[model samples]
Target: MEVRTPWQALTRPLAYPRSVWPWRSAGYLASSVVTGLPALVVLAVLVLFSVLLVGLPLLLLAGVALGGVERRRLRIAEVAPAADPHRVPDVPGLGAWLRVRAREQATWRELAYAVLHATVLWPLDLLAIAVCLGLPAALLSAPVRLALDRQETKVVKAYLVTSYPQAFAAALLGAVLLLALLYPLAALAGARAALTRALLAPRETELRDRIGEVTRSRARLVDAFEAERRRIERDLHDGAQQRLVALTMTLGLARLDAPPGSPLGDQLAKAHDEAGQVLTELRELIHGIHPQVLADFGLGAALADAADRSAVPVDTDLDLPRLPTAIESAAYFAGCEALANIGKHSGATKARLTARYDPGPARLTLLVQDDGRGGADPDRGSGLTGLADRIAVLDGTLTISSPSGGPTLIRVEIPCPPPSA
Candidate 1:
């Protein structure tokens, strides 16, 4: 199996030595001096002159820059890429960028990491490389040192080697030591990579904030949709519906003036009847688009109006105050659909609709129950599936309990803002 992390590679004692991970780890640790040294110099200078007030901002800027670089550098030992936790500025320019970075927790964490790295981590990295790699290299070059000097030579600045055998022996020992130390060196590199990722990657709280922003955006879209529906409803009610009513009245007046039993009188009556039917259909269409009662009174009266029109006899026990428009719309549509289904397919004589609102948690619950030959399944192309999805967008739930024999119940519960007083 392929290994992605140093710790995972360490688990296999044999194949790890043969893999390319050792070189990768060595490279990661060796490169620490590149960024760490510059960071140390910059941080020291900024602190010394920070009384000027300019140094503080520059220091933050430096930290932010270093954070970007370090996140990229983590790719050496970490297979998974680190995501930048700072949000992009709304407007472009250094001023907006700085303002956004200053407000992010990632920026502060990066600054702290930079400080710790400059003071402590770089020295440790340097020391580990020197002892683990440099020492072995020096020992392996013992025979060459002796030959070049034509005399005695100090092995690793400690053991003295005078003869060829001693020089050769030191070289052999160096090779063995180099092989043994690679494991710990790779392990150390893995630890360093993990620390860098922790400071630079997105945090749990930042992820939560991002999810919240997305939900609010969806809610805004739902509100805009409802507003557009209301606009269309208003236009039809005040424009086309009113014109049709006037036409119907004019046709009625013309029919009354015509001679009784004449062809003209029969034609006028037929035209008047057609116009009246058209007006009634338009009124129903306007109401379906968005009920004016819902906008004027609220969900309670709107559901009552719907119950009065349902083909299946419905008894309602609802005591609710005004709610958010989106919530009210969703609940109203769900109730209307339930009653329509009952009238068309339930084969029941009566249905009951119940609604209640709890102020403690500010939740609204509506129930529609019908005593019918019941086997309602949303998966079977039922309209309840659409109702469930719409409710889900508002962080509400739709549940149906329908046995095969009788009595289908649909319950909707939504957390909403407190009703307007």
Candidate 2:
């Protein structure tokens, strides 16, 4: 598997030594000095003048800014990007932004993390890198040191190397030690990344709120889409359909006025027939776009209308009241698609549709079954997948169970409040 972090890289023991992760880890730890030094200075100044009210706000600003920088630095040890835990201000301008940031728990948590990093964490990070990498590097340079000094050299400032052989031996030992120490170095980097993520990433509750917002936005889009469909349906029904009706009537009258059995009369007759056919198709298109019955009378009447128009016989057991327009529309279209699929592919001679609303749970349930040679697969380019996606936007679910020999069943469950609610 591809490695994304130091821990994953460490899992491949043989590859770890040759890999760049050791150097990456060292860089990640050593770079702490860059951030830590500034943080320590700023924090010290804040503490010195903390008795003044100005220090408190400055400290908050410093912590919030440092948190953003540290989250970016975390990428050196971690491949996956960290999500900012803080929410955007509802309004623009600096005052609004500061008020929102100051009110969030994440801001305080980040401030705590900043304090810890400045006082303790960064120092420990530098110390680990020094012990693991700096010492080995010093030892490895013993041969060069001996050559320069010509008499003696200090090995890691601890042992004396008086001869070239001794220096070479120290270097070999340093090489082995460096390789061995890198495992722990990489492990430490991974731990640091995890801690940074834990402190800076969005909490579970925040994540849930984000997901809920996205769901709500998607639902609004779906509502807008349904509204557009209704608008188009209305335009076609009121504007185009009426105009086509007038054209068809005019052609009929012209056919009657033309010479009997003449060529012009025959052509007029053909044109009139064609106009009537076009009008019929346009009406069907309008109904398919957004059925007037579904909007005016609710899903029950719409389902009955759909069943009446189905190619195969369909029996419906509907116990539905007027539902929210979105739910009713979604359920109606889903049922229509199911019956259409049954007629097109299922080879079903008979089908059944059942729908009801449960007031206790505030849920709506719809089931469509067919006594056909059942091998329906929505993944095989069926319209059901898109319908299912639409239903899911409403926090509803659509499931299908079609075994190979016979009998296909599709169940749809949607949690919705009663229309009164």
lDDT of 1 at 405: 84
Q: How far does residue 269 in candidate 2 sit from its true spot (Å)?
A: 9.8
All predictions: root-mean-square deviation over Cα? 11.5, 11.5
TM-scores for all candidates: the values are 0.56, 0.61
**Candidate 2: stretches off by over 4 Å:** 202-250, 258-421
Q: Write the per-residue lDDT of candidate 1 for residues 1-421, one digit (tens) a residue.
A: 6688887889998988898888888888888999899999999999887888878878788888888989888888867678778777866898898899888888898889889888998889999999889998898999999999989999978899999999999999999999999999999999999888888785664576678789999999989999999999989989999999999999999999999999999999999999999999999899888998999999999999999999988999999999999999999999999999899888989999999999987899999999999998888777999999999999999999999988999999999978877
Sliding window of 10 residues with minimal summed lDDT for model 2: 200-209
Misplaced by over 4 Å in model 1 are 1-197, 200-210
Clashing pairs in 2: none
What does the lDDT read for residue 55 in candidate 1? 87
